[model samples]
Target: MSRPDRTHFAPLLRVIHWTMALLVLAMLFIGVGMVSTTGPAYVSLLALHRPLGIAILLLALVRLAIRLGTGAPPLPDDLPKPQKLAAKGSHGLLYAAMIGMPLIGWAMLSAADDRVSLSPSLALPAIMPHDLMLYWWLRQAHTVIGVAFFLLILLHLAAALMHGLIRRDGVWQSMTFGKIPGKRD
Candidate 1:
């Protein structure tokens, strides 16, 4: 058999990438809905957020391992230096937020002396000591990071559209459209 094409991400990585994308978006909206309302539905959204955050964290760890081990396709050589740097920095920030956000949320819950339920019946052990001040700080940091994470996602989407549409570059296909049959004319 021939070697798998390197232009596209490995299939597992692609699956995880899209899966986490949907999950993260849902989590963000659920968080907003949770804060914007009152009563039973709000409580349910809060419950869902914790488990979804954990799922994103677990998937991110696997995605990071695959990224490091297999590596991503290189950006086009014609790409400008500033845009390339922004691409790299944005990607790094995305990964940092993906990994950090859940852990911060987990720690915040722990510091608040709350049991971190992975499910209605399952719970995670506290990674941080119970401290009201720590909980307050972590809560604030989580909010700030969540906003930054959303902004980074918007930037990432804009860059992807630039590569796929305006630039007609294969960078987007490296993660998305997969390998094409022939080289660009």
Candidate 2:
């Protein structure tokens, strides 16, 4: 049976949402720091980044599956059509990046003949054939997409805050702890 309409997200979904949000933000910053520094710390961050990217890739798959199987709370009726479309479009893009970035990273490393080891003892097989030119292009694409993803995240945060603070709409509450202020069905 389909899930009953509800204001707040399913508890598990909420947990996943918050968890992925934190992880994604951490990955973004870690990526920047990894690229900018040169030292022991950089090496440590690089090690951390590999496994974290894999984790995000796996989690994104789970999140997408759950999202597709469940219904989300509807947007507030007062929100304009254009705003609604923008919200939907941005969310779609976020999901795309969430899934694409990790795969790109994995393939890039494979193309560069680098190991995809998660831990000292746990190694992953190559995802793509080795090609220096492909590696270079993927690296550039990853960087550009990372920046765009970061900006999109900022836009999402701004919209959430607008709903939570200025608009006083229940949009934020649907995903947050606050009560659902209207009918769910």
Candidate 3:
């Protein structure tokens, strides 16, 4: 595979980034809907949720591999040390959340002796033993992690806007479609 251009992400990475962004956003909303309702809509939301979570997990793994192989565009040279550290740390947390949340949800279901049905003819094997106490704890952890993930996303968005809008740095444009203004190479 071709390496990404110095000023922009690889095409595949950009595509997957946007796709997973939509998927993660939807998953968050579906999760909230699943927990906040008891009607038939809850069942529908769950059906959407299980498969989407698995999809996110799969995509995240692929994305991480690509990132490790290809790497990302460098941050602006003049960016402060603290901001640069925050950028790296936040990215690490986002990746962790991307990989962790679905696994936690799967394990939570497993502990409850529940099946994670991906389709009528397919399901995931349980990764945790059936234990009500464990299920309760896992469920709580899932909620907390979900909330944290949402906040992380907000922080990420803010940072991106700062790069694109306030700073007019190429950082945001690296992951996006347009050229990085004033960048020669």
Error of 2 at 109 (Å): 0.4
**Model 2 weakest 10-residue run by lDDT:** 1-10
How many clashes (backbone atoms < 3 Å, residues ≥3 apart in a chain or on different chains) does model 3 have?
0
TM-score of each: 0.92, 0.94, 0.95
Badly placed stretches (over 4 Å) of model 1 are 1-5, 181-185
- After superposing candidate 2, which stretches have Cα over 4 Å from the reference? 1-4, 182-185
Q: Ten consecutive residues with minimal summed lDDT in candidate 1?
A: 1-10
Could you say which candidate leads in lDDT?
Answer: 3
Per-candidate clash tally: 0, 0, 0
lDDT of each: 0.85, 0.88, 0.92
Please, what are the lDDT tens digits per residue for candidate 2 over residues 1-185? Answer: 12346666666777888999999999999999989988777999998999999999999999888878776777877899999899989989999999999999999999999998988898889988999999999999999999999999999999999998888777888787767555442
Tell me model 2's lDDT, rounded to 2 decimals.
0.88
Pull out the clashing pairs in model 3.
none
User: What lDDT does candidate 1 reach at residue 121?
Assistant: 88
Candidate 3 deviant stretches above 4 angstroms: 1-5
Q: Which pairs of residues have clashing backbones in candidate 2?
A: none
Clashes of 1: 0
- The lDDT-based order of candidates, best leading, equals 3, 2, 1
